[model samples]
Target: MFDKYLIDVATLRNTGPADAPTGFAFEAKLGYYRGLGLSMIEKLDVSIDGEQLPREAVRFDEGNGPLSLDEMETAYDRRWPFGTPATILIERPGGFPPGEHELSLLQQLRVSYLPFPSTNSDAKSVSFPG
Candidate 1:
């Protein structure tokens, strides 16, 4: 069955000042499931207002290691432990314009219990700092 599976946007920070960085911080509550040996997540897409950002600029941290979009495909050890929080960061230079914007994400996850990989995509509204 498909589900949100702990994928959620925990917090958002708007851009401020001239030299400040604007980005989105996300949290994934990965946990142990019956019969699942490990959870491997690779497909991660982050976009702002329909504009897709480069995966290379997205940062994914799973405590075991830090990986970017560039290494996502090659990184085989990207797994989260049970009941642990995984962090994902996407920073945009110049920051987002002050106002309401749509934040979207698509994640592809694999598990031993499932025959195929499961995908989760979600979007929500966010306001950047003025």
Candidate 2:
């Protein structure tokens, strides 16, 4: 049987002068399979204006660690079970042009028994400078 999970965009902030900081928060509810033993593979993808941002594999509950924003991708093997809630935050670089920008959050879940990882799920998008 497959397990249920969720990918939520807890918050988004744009800190710059002239342009007010835009914040967004949302949650995604879904399901997946419960893996065996003590490790589950998870991947998170963040993009802005269709361009991928640099991200490091860090605990969702814990803020971005020592890794810089140029790391590209973040992957990790967790000891948590399926259906766990993970929160993510995406911060835009300062000086973003005064216009609408598309922000997307993509997530992938993998189980131990499954040969290949599950399909990517699309949560929702937020527009800034509206």
Question: Model 2: which ten-residue window has the lowest total lDDT?
Answer: 63-72
- The candidate that achieves the highest TM-score relative to the unseen native structure: 1
Tens-digit lDDT string for candidate 2 (25-82): 2333334554321223355566657876655422243222322223312424323344
Q: Model 2, stretches more than 4 Å misplaced?
A: 1-10, 14-39, 57-59, 62-85, 95-99
Candidate 1 Cα outliers beyond 4 Å, as residue runs: 1-10, 14-18, 22-24, 29-39, 70-78
Per-residue lDDT of model 1, residues 1-130, tens digit only = 2235555544554433456756556665543342122236656787888988887768777776667766655665455566566676777765555678887777676766789876767677766564
Candidates' lDDT values, in order?
Answer: 0.62, 0.43
Residue 16 lDDT in candidate 1: 37
TM-score of 1: 0.67
